[model samples]
Target: MPDDCRNIYKTCRKAAGLTQEAAAERLGISVESLRAYETGQRVPPNEVVELMVILYNAQHLAFQHLRETNALYSSVVPEVRPRSVLEASAKLTNRIFLFAESHADRRLLRITEDNVIDASERAEFNAIMEDLQEIVEAALELRCARESS
Candidate 1:
């Protein structure tokens, strides 16, 4: 996860003149935990990442990488697709879902405990993952089931 999207997290924190301690305090996390996130050793949950977007004034970063369905109301949702997808049937939505999957893999998520996130956000993240999973599955189906249809 080195130099990954979480770099945006570290850059934004520094640009805002907040040390890791300060930012972690605002996010209700330990400085060590925040360091883990910045270093790409641990991925923060969506709520923590969302809080960073607000704190860092870089909402676009969330839409670009976080795949935040909540960001639809946040005005940072990208107006244009930022990527080209191999699955034409899936397009940007499937690409976004795959990015989401890549960013928060279960192996990576094992480092970030479930208790760090609240019940509501945990539920929301689960729901979002479920929807993204559906999108990804559909894309796979189309890719394997049909060719130049």
Candidate 2:
């Protein structure tokens, strides 16, 4: 319950088309308390979180908090947290770049005048691969930063 429920509370309340006063009334709490919970200035108790789940009729954000905080709840909800997500991402990302990088030598292939593709096409292909490499690297870095944080 110490986990911040700010975004979740706000989003759920908005999605349900309920005003802060209404949502707080449904939970039998004051609007000031609800605001505090949504502002991260206070942590709602477990019962309050459950009331949130009931009020919103969804628990996506609340469950995410539980998964990050309570290992006991996480184990009972194995599919809630997927393992090897990073490993799978790295494997696929590396394989894509490796294939493109290994094919760099292909840029040197000669083409007869009769060939449909000329030097321009070859250069463009190489350029595209280079761009793809950079994009892939950036994606991996962004993912690492997000997961770590």
TM per candidate comes to 0.43, 0.45
In terms of lDDT, the best-performing candidate is 2
Instruction: Write down the worst ten-residue block by lDDT for model 1.
Output: 76-85
Clashes in model 2: which pairs? Answer: none
What lDDT score is found at residue 83 in candidate 1? 27
Candidate 1 Cα errors over 4 Å, as ranges: 2-4, 67-149
lDDT of 2 by residue, 20-138 (tens): 99999999999999998787777677788878876875545456556545789766543222124465466557756766686643543433234666666777666655656555544
Report the lDDT of model 2 for residue 25.
91
Best by TM-score: 2
Residue-by-residue lDDT tens digits, candidate 1, 30-98: 999899878777778788887886776554445544542344543532232222234535563655667
